[model samples]
Target: MSAPIQLRPDETFILNVGPQHPATHGVLRVKMQMDGEYIVKSETVLGYVHRMHEKMGENRTYAQFLPNLSRLDYLGALGYTHGHVLAIERAAGIEVPERAEYIRAITVELNRVASHLFWFGAFVMDLGGFSPLMYAIQDREHILDMLEAVTGARLTYCYYRFGGLYNDVDDNFIEAAKRFIPRMRKSLKKYDALVTGNIIFRKRLEGIAPVSAEMCRKYGATGPVARGSGINFDVRKNEPYSVYPEFDFDIPVYHECDSLARYRVRMDEMEQSLRIIEQGLEKLPDGPFMAEKKPKTIKLPVGDYYQAVETARGSFGIRIVSDGDKNAYRLKLRSPTYSNMHLFDEACEGMLIMDALAFMGSLDLVIPEIDR
Candidate 1:
């Protein structure tokens, strides 16, 4: 063994911030090199929640692997699942019913809203405020209950299937959705009043951890992280798929490139999702929910295929390679958090520990998604 090297009393020491820390919100651990209350440098340590989701995909049939996507990002499960189904269906050239696309849009947007609500609460709580969590959960439960009424589960839902949805929505689901839009709008206005303008919240965020547009491109960060930095890109708009093209919504972008900017993106995104859900309901056509003559089993072309979707976090993409078989030869999941997290080590350098944590919360990381 080599001789132990000791540092002098004034040297920086390491602080392990998680793997159980509440501020992390998951099993993410930050190896932070600290000097007093400031971080000199940091390294994010992942894999605490790794499930090998890509390997899981390779081991199962396309249909069988569908549910696993949900486990990748628990808060934003539907978007991950949506990208999977879309990848498979697009490569196979399978057609979905018009009605199913509308319902999918409705449910997926609901999921997005639910994910953002939870993030809003958890993020504010990360900065030491707790009441937002209570209110946010209160609203999120309404979404979960509605999704569960049809999908049969709240969190990890496999309600969507290859080529279409497993079931058509009922009258109750539609009416509940109509009621939810206005209720959510009122709640959003309440949140703006309660949290957005608070001097403490603004002080905690405004100029901390500034990410440049060039920095976002360098790290391949997507979703609100890129938008917060004023890079105007969203897969739903930039690369339209499903019924996203039929609906009208704006991509919220802020050039401030700080925690507050990312916060505003998510808050504004909830409103846009509401606009999509409302438009989906208004233009919801009457037809079959699943494509007629679609095969019960899935088999893909010999070449590789890729699909991307704008998840609650950012872009979640799935790439599949096939050998004309029911199972994928290779499966690769491109998670936005994984790309977004790369910038943290460099970004947090010389930041006060509290501001670094707040900056991380602004990233909206889902640890399992990254580890996968």
Candidate 2:
């Protein structure tokens, strides 16, 4: 007979980090049980902003449902648009023009920069910094203006077509972007000095949410989350698509595996994206923007097609199943935030409630992307 097993008792408390909390960015609720200020367990509650977007895709025609793409991650409109368009084009066996492919790469890269800038500001703001948010927004507004001139929308742009872009970029747009890049480079320098080097900011982020490379892969995390953990897997580089293979850029990796590492990864990725954009501009080809044979009635073949693109948050995938009909039979979205959030329970354990929020911010979870 064995003696009764004794269990150690530890003081613990519960903390809720909000469905309406400022740091969440959208409707996300995290319930955490804590030992003093450190978390012992945590659960994330979602679906507050669910729109059943995949179901809508099954009912609506491919052309009619274009608007839904941007709504998933409104911050990276080009990234979302590229994923859907690539999926549909592959399903329909359409070829995008050379010029169109270059344009797609450029616009999507610009959108990635804008999205990262917004995240940089918001992440800092979560740690009680405000001025950097304002400066970051100022840089982001220039990107919005540049995108709006071509797409006619700032946030939720529905610009990409089935096989190519909706329209060609004019000389003025390219010139504006060329002018904007130099100014943006100078601004990024200031952002580094102001926020990245600040002692308080570094203190708040260091050693919070430390995840290993094994944990990142097990959780199916990508983008900065995986990169922060020393994984060199960028869809653009590992699985080259469109004009990405032709472009020269670096896949930034950080071994820190902490909140500051994730933050630095994104910042470094922004610099790399800027380089991609510049190279794309220099190599811009002259050709049609949209496929000349684009059909008004897209009757997709009976097959399933999967497409993946790297977004600001991470890799976004679209799975379209067509039944040789005008409308798709099934549409599935494999969003990055969903995969990234799965690691939260493991990362937040034994961390403080404040550190948990910082961890959440570091992952850069866009709730609508998860909920959709």
Candidate 3:
């Protein structure tokens, strides 16, 4: 927690929630001005775990910075890696193989599912429902195992290469993924029963911290945060990348604009991610996973190039300025968590302290992503 701030002579005072508290969710510190149990205003203090990822991109070679992408959002690392690789490929005119596109899409979607599963567990745990955390983690373990079999890492995965994956997945990995879909569907049914339909859970979330469509726009929120407020903007649908256009999937949206709506959006998104994964597997083609003609030293023309990918959290983007060199001249990462977390100050105003915490949880923050 941060040191206490001085307050006026009135009963109103500042309360330091965390730089280390579990409720702040990942090295986040929130200074809340409170009147009794209600919050007057709140400010989020970041930079606790800043790694300067964009600076690393400038110093390292195009290929050397691949691992740094995973470190930003460890839960959905593949999506970050995808954005970085796609940016480099686009800038250098590297043509990725068709099979590699399918593999990238498949692995990224699986990572999305794992990320949402972990979020479901952690969010429920935040709300005082402990058992669902265990159930969610139990199901998430299967995805981790499946991804580990192919990527060789469970958590901070650096699986994708500039024009393909580090290696191609085998038949056994495909079989395991095929089995996982049906099992996960069954688990979702149980989750709906145990958490969604519960009266206590519904009461805690239903009308709390309502976010309007206008608020989302002003704050630059995306993913479930924007979707919950009835915005139909998904990076996958709006700007098609990889093999996502080849697959059919619905972008889940909820008009309620409350915490429940955000929760519902993520829950429904897991199903859509599963659909994409299944279609990618069914349409798997026979070809080399890596491009045969990639140069050893990647040098881009003197220009700016940008690539965007829809990660589990939201729109993740990489913008690179190249000077026809092996390394980037200027690199910037547009992380979704940073934009989403920007809404907290306005959103939490006049809310109960408990409700404010719940609202923060609904935003699905990963602080390192923000601090980066």
Candidate 4:
């Protein structure tokens, strides 16, 4: 690892949180300059799990890179996959059918819920609440079952294709999603009582790590991180990709900007995602799942094209440069986690180490997403 941050001989000392601490979450190392329990400064050291996904994109054919999207953020794999597919489709001038678009949106929103649920459990566990992790996992398992019935993988899903989806979702998938919405609503009520109202939970989070709207802009943060700060920008609502424009859903925002506000934003977002899924199901059209006509050898036009989609974390964008080649001339992934993580060094200053770690958890980072 990089040498621990240097300071005066005895006044401040460096502590390495992880390249493998549970709280650091997924092979991350944070070198903190600590004056006893309080952190004077911190630097997040990344790249332990860098798989060079962007380099893989340049080496692989357009279709070959579809599967790599999942490895970046396994928890919210579909969102990344959706961005990749949409980028390629737009570059190649392929039109996705209405039914396929609805299916993509439904599945992606379900994946978003799953991601947030996982985060809820993990974050609670980090704060020493063990029981809620079990509850969160139990609820998330149902989502996995629903996704597995169609995608054939619980995590690291590679279901979305260039023009549409690899396969069409059936009535069983639709019915299960319909059933899941109400069941999840009940679970949300339980979480509100069990976790949100808990005095200890609030004490730990309520006034900690206050991220301002200006900080969000400076760091290019999006998703709940931005929403919690009262900057109303969601790629789905603001950019309007796929069939999301047809749905009626509100982007939840809280001006508190503390960890609790971030937590509340995610909890409220699960409800909004359910609303999107329900509307998407109701309006799902009857048509081919994939485009009837597509190029045998997929190639982008001689220009650059970009597409952005809102994931469970924040806005994810894919930029592709092409000279009419089957493979990308340059493929760049703009992951939200990388931008969100940028604020950690400045945000952690002057806070206790535990609070700083909790603040890190609130960002909902996926390490591979950043390492990529």
TM-score of each model, paired residue for residue: 0.97, 0.96, 0.97, 0.97
User: Which candidate model has the greater TM-score, 2 or 4?
Assistant: 4
C-alpha lDDT of residue 5 in model 4: 75
Q: Which lDDT value does model 1 have at 252? A: 97
Strongest candidate by lDDT: 1
* lDDT agreement of model 1 with the native: 0.93
- Per-residue CA lDDT of model 4 for 1-372, tens digit only, reads 998876665698889999999997799999998998999988889999999899999999988998999999989999999999999888888998888899999999999999999999999998989998899999999999999989999998999887778898889988888999999999999999999999988888999999999999999999999999999999998889899899999999999999999999999999999999999988889888988888888988899999999999999999999988898999999999999999989988999888988898899988999998
Tell me the TM-score of model 2: 0.96
How many clashing pairs does model 3 include? 0
Better of 1 and 2 by TM-score: 1
Candidate 3 accuracy as TM-score? 0.97
lDDT of each residue in 1-372, candidate 1, tens digit only: 997887677899899999899888899999998998889889888899888888888899999998899999999898999999999889999998999889998999999999999999999999888999999999999999999998988999999988799999999999999999999999999999999999999999999899999999999999999999999999999999998989879999999999999999999999999999999989999989888878778889799899999999999888899999999999999999999999999999999999999999999988888998
Any runs in candidate 2 off by more than 4 Å, and if so which?
1-11
In each prediction, how many residue pairs overlap at the backbone (N, C-alpha, C within less than 3 A)?
Answer: 1, 0, 0, 0
Cα lDDT tens digits, model 3, 32-100, are 989988898888888999989889989999899988889888888999999999998888888999999
Q: Judge candidate 3 at residue 223 and give its lDDT.
A: 91
- Candidate order, lDDT descending: 1, 4, 3, 2
> Which one wins by lDDT: 1 or 3?
1
| TM-score-superior candidate, 2 or 3 | 3
- Name the runs in model 1 displaced over 4 angstroms: 1-10
Between 2 and 3, whose lDDT is larger?
A: 3
* Model 4, runs deviating above 4 Å: 1-10
Residue 296 displacement in candidate 1 (angstroms): 2.6
